[model samples]
Target: MQKIVDTAKGLEGLKRQWGVHAAGVILSRDPLVDVLPIHKREQDGAIITQWDMGACESIGLLKMDFLGLRNLTILDDCLDAIRENRGEDVVLEQLPLDDKPTYELLARGDTLGVFQFDGGPMRALLRSMIPDNFEDISAVGALYRPGPMGANAHNEYADRKNNRKPVVPIHPELAESLADILGDTYGLIVYQEQVMAIAQKVAGYTLGKADLLRRAMGKKKKEILDKEFQPFSAGMKEQGYTDAAIKTLWDILVPFSDYAFNKAHSAAYGVVSYWTAYLKANYPAEYMSGLLTSVGDDKDKSAVYLAECRRMGIKVLPPDVNESMARFAAVGQDIRFGLAAVRNVGTNVVEAIRRCRKEKGAYTDFYDFLRKVDAVACNKKTIESLIKAGAFDSMGHPRKGLLAIHADAIDSFLDIKRNEAVGQYDLFGDAFGGGDDAVGAGMVVTPQIPAGEWDKGDLLTFEREMLGLYVSDHPLFGVEHVLTAAADMTIGALAEESSVGDGAVVTLAGILSGVQRRITKQGRAWASATLEDLGGAVEVLFFPNTYEIVGQYIAEDAIVVVKGRVDRRDDQPRLMAMDMSLPDITAADEVKPVVLALPRPGARRRWSSGCARC
Candidate 1:
């Protein structure tokens, strides 16, 4: 055991693997190959330096990080969509920083898809701060991290910004010098740049030396911090600052340096965050379409954006063969689901559909679509998926009716094409049809079936199966009142950072799906299910004790009310079920009256005598 312990200690700080940085690149005046060891990456054969970023920097080489942000791509797509759909050229760089609508959107906490302010806690902070300008956005980004949040800096910043708390300088002696540096952040030390500026102005340190002090403070090394403080204090005293003021400033710098973010970096993020909010405020459909298209393949992400769209009052129509493109597109004031997002539908099929629509105009009907679509791409499975996904609904056919007749329609269309390939003419072709167009039309007859549609639940299930979500309506639509009356919060609220703390009891009502029962190592049965409300879905766990009582009610598509303690161990919250019951609208609607009667002496005897007389 001693030998093992010694070996583990020796390996604690040793490098275990070599990895390439995601975005970091080393720059050198001389050829990199001549200056440093280099090798080709095994995965892509890209040239890479042997030394890591810190090692390269230590040798006087410049290391630059070129980050590829998805939000930037989303912005580009959104701008193009706005130009194409609305004929508006929206240049993000030229967008006004003080746009009133943008600030209003942030103030309302409707930042579900905005870049930096989209998280629940960040949204709540934005609401509390009621950011009225770009500076507030940057400060919120800097203060939302664990370190600042743990220190309650975000709340303090919010309070200061909203005038709930007064902003005061660190020291009256250095007030004039520090205000210029920290005024934008409501007198809070939010940025590393501010720290450097403070040292330069109040302590009379050179810019380079102040930066060294900033780095030393940021590292939080006792020895380095202790050494850096002597010069800071000496310089402050030389500048006529009192010893007490210097000590007070030093006390703040020591702890705050740990979480102070780079002001420039926060401002850069603020620009992108503002751009997204601006576009969402002005062109919601275009922006949401771009956002949905960016995550079209990811169902969970798509569901989140879809919910956001609903909240924005933008209707996200289901996939329509004529209206939808390969990816999500803005259709007037609404957004249309993309054909490529439908399960079992390939890009090739979506391309074929688009090509056919462009070449032959909008699909007139289901029969016309079958005749004009590329037969090679429009296979039986693809057609069925499109039908189930509501892609063919605009052709005036019920989804169930189309599903019933699609096979025969495809077979009949194929037969006509086969005959045409063989150069065979029907005996009654010319007699029934005068020209090629008429002959083609007369070859395959559209099948007629009952006009009945599937039940709401079945339709939603098919949409979930094919489109990965319910677009026409959600399962919790009609039962919302009942759920609202019983549940403490929605499933989506569980995802918010500020919604509930760990182990806090909460009640939620939603339709249960994906229920799985398993036996624990202790040979006890336990279960897990996804509880989905209108807002979103959350996982609910039923341990052995709870499972024994609620096992009978646990099944797929079961609408149940769950009472549980929130488990926020993961990035998202899950519910540890304490009780579960079916959502009963009748029971929820019943208002039992409380008949209270004051107790009287001999009341029981009087009631018994009255009953005997009766």
Candidate 2:
């Protein structure tokens, strides 16, 4: 208050804010004279003084940031999932930078949790402009933006990577100045470091000055840029560069400066990209688990993650109370769906279930669970959500049975406890001790299924309804072989062979994992068709032509084979189905295994012994 009053009394436009200044305050042998007459408090038999940041800095104290980046947490979670799933502790930091699979992942746009590639548009860009090298990853990280979305940049990038195009030199003299920065990115200014290096090499700018200019360009200050340009041009000519070459290079470099991305930032994110690639290539199950685990409470995200899991052929098992943690967990390679992901199933409820299960064993049946933690963790709505989510199907009941009986089961459970509390215990006198014969123990009063059981399709659909995904199995598992010969490829292999404009006629058979649609700029809706083969998954592009014909077959988890060209648009590749078929599995027949016979050891010896006589 006194400082504020003093600042208010100062000259006009004082601009007083909390500021730190540096000064040396020495302690004398006689402690009283060296110090100012100010309030002092002792701290553990020591004097404590508060100093501001600038004061500390001026006094040569170093500042270190304890930065907790979200990416780091995500990285940790991803690694943890990988470790749990793969049973190997992969040190992501130690991965080789030039991994083929890592580059391949970028090329294919399988960029979920892949550092800077996590955004929808970024994935689309990666798919369209398949990055073939770490430098491509870095360059894309830098080059992709509103301003730097250069004409034919994606094509140029792809061509350069495939060695179909040369790394063009903007200026003959500046070749060495740009070579290292360009690396495999074909002489593009895709990193701020490149700009800095260019400034240093071409115009003799100090690193500090280069950084300042880079910042000025990013700020897009006309006056500052104009002032800086004269020195830059003069420096260029002094180095014996022609005026025309300098001007041309300057035009390219100046525009790039506006969004000249940081190289360190790109490198850091590239590490995450590489880590995800390594996981996808070597430890897919763990990658899927982490991917699914992180999609907290988002059915849409989970749906996408699940589709990726299926695409990767990583099995996502239904949420088993016994196996499931509050969050999604990896049980072997299978992602045990998270209880927290179910609608209305709060974290607290999940914690309660976790605690109850820890105290006891896994709920023997749904009723065993209901008796102990149901009232505490689950309400009618919570139970209903769990039913709809299929968290209880493992309790020896169809999902419909569980869903139908939830109210009666819950009410009956409450009534039984109430009766036992009141004086009605003798009516259900302990047939055995310790309430072992309790009404809801070892048996739950579920509604009866009709005479016939649910068909495979219905069962899968029920699981899908609850899990926000198909977990038990894909709908098209039976037609996997037929689909394979038709498609002539595995999902993992599709991206390996195709060129940017090349297309392959294939028959892809799989269960319809999911369909996501979006409107293009001109208001035309385009859809992405996700299908899961027995081996893995392939994404089909539903162009207006394909969607009009096969859209209905795709909406259900039906067994369908799509005949289409292997589509390459963005660096990513997927099948754009032009034809669809649903094959019948019932018409197929099974055959028995054949066994070979061998002589017994003693008989062989006898035969050998008798051979001379024969």
Candidate 3:
């Protein structure tokens, strides 16, 4: 007995590759021979260990996959928004799977906030499929995959929901196995659990053995499958299932299991998917706020989110040090833009401004604010960035004017604050009362806005940066009529056009969305840029265009109109820009400021606020 035990232990201790494995001795440099195989590759100069479950058991090692995920962040934000808005902290685990609002949202393709199912194709699928329950959502989530090529899953789901087809079961035993899933997609084999059930019931395999088979099937392992299929088939035959029926079921399953998604994984993602849907449906303000806040640094995404908010009739207010928070904040249905998102302005500046406001109330004006905070914290570049981003719009200064006086204003503000702090009062301090006298003295050096000088391009640029989308007005304001007549299109009409020929001669107007740089084969830089209108986004190509035109206007959210013909470069239809210019695209060829007729006092303020969203 001792000899037998020793022999078994010795054989188990052998490392086969690096040394020898003759006569169970494992004669190697080390007595405790390393049984695990060292993985080697030329491309990446390292020996990787192949120690997955099967590899571990064979080579006497252990292995586990450590997965980090982003869905948790989505989960956290959803719960926080829910708690903050409704006073109800929802534990998604306790929420019913059959949520009506969730399904309604899925049906409408308003899955922007949804987790995995937020893609363009998925959104289109949701609009058509019209899911009625959580099971439908889960099944759609599982079926709307690459396997169902050309949107077969979406079509199948939509057809089943509209009673255009009957739900069919593959086998009698599968009736019970597929009953729960059928509630949504009428017994579609859309989940891994269904596969395991079929294996367990039809093949008479134990759950553990079935799981191994499932894993083997998922991995498409030939050797393990060859070892397992005989018993599986024999067990099914013993249960009186005909070979033809078995083959049919197996045929349907093998392909899907080839891409068979994990039902557990989809269900977890569905929770976030449902939450985003719920947020979009129920709390547009808070949802937009969080969405804007999360993507503040990503100008492209921020602009897109702003467009979505506008479509939802939610306003995105411009940044004001007094009125706006550092992060996107909800002001009724409107989302106040984040100050931290402005280019060149560090997030620390936003936090400092917010801290100053919280410590003291709303700032009285420029001088009052300068007294509390250091102007040096926001440097020239930072001030210009904020000015371009419309951070001081609420101070009643046009962006151009604010930028013009930025340096002098900072210097005078710092001087006044320093003097005030040291109790150095002016000679006439108590003459008209101390407060009135201080205000009058400060007023002399304070920056002033010119009465009639709001430039159209500047307005659009400022609004574009602050609101994250073109609001206040589009750059092609007067040119929209021309674009409509010339290209037979508006900003909203681009998507309907076919991707054929040289496309259309589109004269659409938009804020210059972004410029993406790439190096050509000749090692010269070229750019593919985006121009966004109120309608949607259009891609534009600029090979040598950036050099001729002003590059300074390419700053984040600068409004520019592209008068280029539409063309398809790489299968995707895009605008091939022949000419691009700033907001003054008038045939007159001169920049001009906008003139407004004054309304009654009440209507004047109202018009100004409404214009903020134009």
TM-score of each: 0.88, 0.61, 0.69
- Candidate 3 global CA lDDT score: 0.64
What is the C-alpha local distance difference test score of each model? 0.84, 0.66, 0.64
lDDT for 400 in candidate 3 is 72
Kindly list the per-residue Cα lDDT of model 3 for residues 35-76, writing each as its tens digit: 654456567674554443454446444343444444556456
The collision pairs in model 3 are: 182-187, 472-614
lDDT of 1 by residue, 412-483 (tens): 877766676687767677775543344346666777855999998888899899987879898766567788
Better of 1 and 2 by lDDT: 1
Q: Pick the candidate with the highest TM-score.
A: 1
In candidate 1, which residue ranges exceed 4 Å CA deviation? 1-13, 418-440, 497-505, 518-524, 565-573, 586-614
Candidate 3 TM-score versus the reference: 0.69
The runs of at least 3 residues in candidate 2 whose Cα sits more than 4 Å from the true structure, single-residue gaps closed, are 1-71, 83-87, 98-100, 118-136, 151-157, 176-185, 221-223, 357-359, 364-374, 377-379, 418-431, 435-614
Q: Please give the range of 10 consecutive residues that has the lowest summed lDDT in model 1.
A: 593-602
